[model samples]
Target: MSRRCELTGKAVLTGNLVSHSNRKTRRRFLPNLVNVTLTSDALQRSVKLRVSANALKSVDHRGGLDAFLIKASVDDLSPKAAELKRAVQKATASTAAAA
Candidate 1:
């Protein structure tokens, strides 16, 4: 409903536009949001969401938006899955000594 990304929690940011001449003006930085159908486990139907472009990129990078939503909707399993996945990733890192 709002002009915000539901998936990534991105919202419009208000600030001052500063010029080279030290002049400032009011401006707004809007989030890049798109209305999309996200698979919903709770409703057992595809739900619409306002998701940011970056979040969409994350989805795109890791297969697709559907895959990202499925991963997000899975409860109880996600945390453990994320932890294990991170651990495996960390172990595989070439710069382990640097870390």
Candidate 2:
């Protein structure tokens, strides 16, 4: 699997590591990614995802996985996350319609 966040789509960034002697070396800045299982109220299940620490915090800040997925933009999300967002939206819409 690639070194990328499944939620925010954060990936390795290329940069230069400069030394005190003004020497610059090519380096990669990787996102702080972790494997986590987040529970979705809409799905009534837990989903495992590789996400950055910042993305994880944003998910929590948004209240839950379903809310975060709904609020996040499709352009910023990974393919899997975009799919999950659609599923969550569908589930919530159906539930709302039933109610």
> lDDT, candidate 2, residue 29?
99
**Per-model RMSD to reference:** 11.0, 0.8
Error of 1 at 38 (Å): 3.6
For model 1, where is the 10-residue window of minimal lDDT?
Answer: 73-82
Whole-structure CA lDDT of model 2: 0.93
**Per-residue lDDT of model 2, residues 1-99, tens digit only:** 999898888899999999999999999998999999999999999999999999989999999899889988899888888999999999999999999
lDDT of 1 by residue, 1-99 (tens): 667666555688999999999899999999888877655332334555567888878867867544454455333223433443344344445345566
Superposed Cα deviation of residue 50, candidate 1 (Å): 1.4
* Model 1 residue 16 CA deviation in Å: 1.6
State each model's CA lDDT, in order. Answer: 0.59, 0.93
**lDDT over C-alpha atoms for residue 73 of model 2:** 88
Q: Which stretches of candidate 1 lie over 4 Å from their true place?
A: 39-45, 64-99
Error of 1 at 52 (Å): 1.2
lDDT of 1: 0.59
